[model samples]
Target: MIRVLLFADLQEKAGIREIEISAEKLTINGIREHIMELYPQLTAIKTAMPAVNEEYAEGEQVVKAGDIVAFIPPVSGG
Candidate 1:
């Protein structure tokens, strides 16, 4: 089980801030796919950036069970 923190549209669309997926080692790409599966409106999640343990991560980043993953969309504020 992995802990995922949703943000912005993701939270609004899914009505949940965190989710636990059933996987031993879930990759960044795999997370996107799972998110899209859970929230069909978030298909664009594949283009967003994800972080593992508060560090910038890539599409192929490996997320093991018990790891904390944060989903961060592009930031823009003045």
Candidate 2:
């Protein structure tokens, strides 16, 4: 299982900060697609950035079972 971290308003919107999913060997893009399919409310994440192991990751980066995947939405502040 891979641990997925949701940040900012996504956490509140999803009603959870994190979740575990079975996505061994799937790329970040694949995970994003899966999330969109499962949770239509989080469709905003379609344009969000993905991170793995605390580092910014590419869409094609494959995720391992023990990896932590985080969907980071664009932040705004002034």
Candidate 3:
């Protein structure tokens, strides 16, 4: 299973901070799509950045079982 970590507003919108998906290795885009399907309320999630094993991941980055994937939403400060 692939472990997913949600941060900031993404976590609030989804009402959860973590999730696990049972599937073969999935690309960053694929994981984004899966999240959207599971939590449509997180509309802003599409713009979130995906990370694998604590490093930023690219669109084609592959996330495999036991990997820690995180979705970091945009944040701003004054």
Candidate topping TM-score: 3
Cα lDDT for residue 31, candidate 1: 88
TM-score of 2: 0.91
lDDT of 1: 0.86
User: Model 2, range 2-65, lDDT digits (tens) per residue?
Assistant: 9999998778788988888875788998888888787779977877889999999999999999
Per-residue lDDT, model 3, residue 67, is 95
> Which of candidates 2 and 3 reaches a greater TM-score?
3
> Candidate 1, 67: how far from true, in Å?
0.4
Judging by lDDT against the true structure, name the best candidate: 3
User: Candidate 3's residue-wise lDDT over 1-78, tens digit each?
Assistant: 999999999999889999899987999889889989999898877888888999998979988898999999889899
Descending-TM-score candidate ranking: 3, 2, 1
lDDT score, candidate 1, position 16: 92
RMSD of each: 1.3, 1.0, 0.8
By summed lDDT, which 10 consecutive residues of candidate 2 come out lowest? 38-47
Top-down lDDT ranking: 3, 2, 1
- Per-residue lDDT over 1-78 for candidate 1, one digit per residue giving the tens place of the 0 to 100 score: 999998897777788999999899978998888888888987547766789999989989899999999887776789
